[model samples]
Target: MTSDCLFCRIVAGEIPATVVHETDATLAFRDIAPKAPVHVLVVPKAHYADVAELAKADPALAGQVLAAGAAVADAEGLTQDGFRVIFNAGEHGGQEVFHVHAHVLGGRPLGPMVSS
Candidate 1:
């Protein structure tokens, strides 16, 4: 785990978080600065810079992270009403956190997410 990486810190329990889900491969937790009522971040335990980084080192891990995201939505009961899974790639995309993570959002109408 990267000592300076926030996500790694979360995984290491250096920081406190309201956990939503966890597995051998990943962890899901409530976002400290949430955008929605059900905003959660799903990340791999092992650090990767971003999607571009993850895609090469562990393609299976990338798919697993996405699968876990769906599991989080299902567990949170956001599937019926519908939910959105998003990953911001870089600074240009408003990715304040460098570690690869998927944001699971729902529980209310998400209008024009791509408009911005």
Candidate 2:
């Protein structure tokens, strides 16, 4: 875990987050700023600069992150209707934090995948 990473701090218990689910390799928590009624961030315990780095370095752990996101959606009752899992990467992708995280969003109709 990088000492400077925000998610790493959360994983290390240096910062407080409203966690929803946890596993040996993953942690799911609610987003402080929710765009949807149900918005959760699923992240791997191990730090990665972004999803691409995580996927390339440890595919299994990346899968675990996806599984945790699915679990979060199911637990939040988003499985029935539908949900969106987003991994914002870099500045162009709108990533505010360096640590890789999956944003699981649902609870209502999420209009479009992207807006112009």
Candidate 3:
């Protein structure tokens, strides 16, 4: 786990979080600074700097993250009307968290998101 990564601390139980779902490989929690009505961030347990880093290591892990994100979107009741799943790959993409995370946003008029 990264010493200064907030999500890592949350996963380790060092920090408190309202977790929505968790499995062996992933954890879904509410974003501290949510941009949408239903903003959840699903992240892999293992530490990967960003999507670029994750993509280079294990392609399966990438699938797992996406699957987890889909599961969260379903659970949050956004399947029919739809939802937005986003991953900020790098600085240019506004990836502040560093660790790989899929943002699940829905429950309102989503309109056009920052990215797909």
Candidate 4:
């Protein structure tokens, strides 16, 4: 885990977070600044710069991260109502953190995908 990466710090226990779920390969925590009623950041234990890097380096691990997100969504009671799993790729994609993480969002109907 990188010293400067926020998510890495959380994974390494250097930073405290509201962890909702954890596994050998992944971790799920509530977003400090949540955009939705149910917003969780699910990350891989091992550090990767972003989704592209994670997918290229370890496809299976990438799947594990996604699976963890889905599991968190289900446990959060969002499965029946539906939810959105999002991976913001880069700066242009709205990714603030460099670590590879997915945002599990639900609790109410989301608006359109994009707005001007």
Best model per TM-score? 2
Residue-by-residue lDDT tens digits, candidate 3, 9-97: 88898999989989899999999888888899999999998988988998899899999999999999999989999998888988888
lDDT of 4 by residue, 1-113 (tens): 88999999999999999999999999999998887889999999999988999999999999999899989999999999899999999899898899989999988888866
Residues 15-116, candidate 1: write the lDDT tens digits. Answer: 999999999999999988788889999999999989889999999999999999999999999999999999899999878889999999988898977332
Candidate 3: regions farther than 4 A off: 114-116
TM-scores for all candidates: the values are 0.95, 0.96, 0.94, 0.95
Per-candidate RMSD, Å:
1.6, 1.5, 2.0, 1.7
> Which of 2 and 4 is ahead in TM-score?
2
Candidate 3's displacement at residue 65, Å, is: 0.7
lDDT of 2 by residue, 29-72 (tens): 99998988988999999999999999999999999999999999
Please identify model 4 stretches exceeding 4 Å from their true place.
Answer: 114-116
Evaluate model 4: give its lDDT: 0.92
> Worst lDDT window (10 residues) for model 1?
107-116
Selected candidate, larger lDDT, 2 vs 3: 2
What TM-score would you give candidate 2 relative to the actual structure? 0.96
Alpha-carbon error at 43 in model 2, in Å? 0.6
In model 1, the runs with Cα more than 4 Å from the true position are 114-116
